[model samples]
Target: MKVLALLLASLAAVSAQTEPWCRCAAFVTYEHSEIMVFEAPEVTIDSCTDDAKQCKNSCTKELNDFSNNGNLWLVQENGLTVGQNICTYMADHFFYFIHNHRVYGYFEVCGGAWEYTGVASQQLLCCNGGKHEHCISK
Candidate 1:
């Protein structure tokens, strides 16, 4: 019985850590109006930061290649992660979030889409929980 208790406790801990740390959903408001969500498996705040950066890079590249659009990059001005009160901004398209995952039984999630706002000429189209197309405020 003690062994069983220990096993249960261990599982609880693992499940807790396996929560999602970052997420990006591709939304085609102009075309399909569907949102494709992606999220990384639960990890520590440090790993979450790294994964967030990687997802941003990969998703943006994929969208650019798929659409032949100009390069859309998320410059990680601040190395931030989950549990951090400050919202980390990326190339004005994506923002930082904590504890969100998509796809069941997956340890990682990543995707991309060519999302544009009418103001694309004036601002960068980006992801932040929701879509935000705007210039980085000075």
Candidate 2:
């Protein structure tokens, strides 16, 4: 019986694919550059309570620094006001999301690296970004 149970448990574990994607608590949009005819500028406010805001800014600057004045963006959200799931494969730079259970629809980062959790094996890691003072100001 013990052998059978162990085998079953191991099989279940193997069958489960741990897709560690960044889960956001609010809808987020990241624009790497200015869109033609789209005058709305990217978020310049550093109001994220976590590193999400800085991460977004880092990724944006990274892309823009190497591009030929072209714009790229990625939006991850369920609806107009709901959070969405994001993965590293969706863009060139790695991204992650932050959720503050203290409030509903509070903070979220669509595709950016705000802080490093210190765990080297984490899935959603910042490509070349780190912590920022403003990310924790609030």
Candidate 3:
């Protein structure tokens, strides 16, 4: 009985660590009556921040490559991950959320045809679990 109890407790701890922090879905709306929605795996805030950092680094590299190739349209204005906020660019869309803030998730409006550019000429939308607002959940 003691061994069984210990085993059960160990399993519970492991499962808890592996569990997702929240279930999130992002939506991108276009001006031409088009919308795209993406479902993200349940991810914790820490993981989200890590993802954003990775994205920033990758995007910076891409920008460098473009500049080296004589493409002047794309430039790294400022670091993507900075201050208390982090923005993660995931292919077609990007998400930004404040670190340590009570935000459920972040969102950005992607314009034009889907592109993998670091930043797009688009609008910004934020969801921080404000009054009369809802956010992502587990």
Candidate 1, residues 4-120: lDDT per residue as tens digits?
999999999978765334342333223343332332232333354346555445445443432233222333234322112112222223544312221111122322223232111
- Cα TM-score per model: 0.29, 0.19, 0.20
Against the true structure, candidate 1 has what lDDT? 0.34
Root-mean-square deviation per candidate: 15.7, 17.7, 16.1
Output the worst ten-in-a-row residue range by lDDT, candidate 3.
103-112
Tell me how many residue pairs clash in candidate 1: 5
> Candidate 3 residues 28-80, lDDT tens each?
44446423323333334334323444433443343334233222222335522
> What overall lDDT goes with each candidate model?
0.34, 0.29, 0.33
* lDDT for residue 92 in candidate 3, whole number 0-100: 22
For TM-score, candidate 1 versus 2, the one ahead is 1
Please give the distance, in angstroms, between residue 88's alpha carbon in candidate 3 and its true position after superposition: 25
Best by lDDT: 1
Per-residue lDDT of 121 in model 1: 13
List the candidate numbers ranked by lDDT, top first.
1, 3, 2
Pairs in steric clash, model 1? 19-42, 93-126, 93-127, 94-127, 95-128
- The lowest-lDDT stretch of 10 consecutive residues in candidate 2 is 117-126
Choose 1 or 2, whichever is better by lDDT: 1
Q: Clashes in each model (backbone N, CA, C under 3 Å)? A: 5, 1, 0
Query: Per-residue CA lDDT of candidate 2, range 1-138, in tens?
Result: 999999999999967834322322221223463111111123334433354655444434433332212211222243211112122321223333332211111222434433321111111212112211112222
Ranked by TM-score, top first? 1, 3, 2
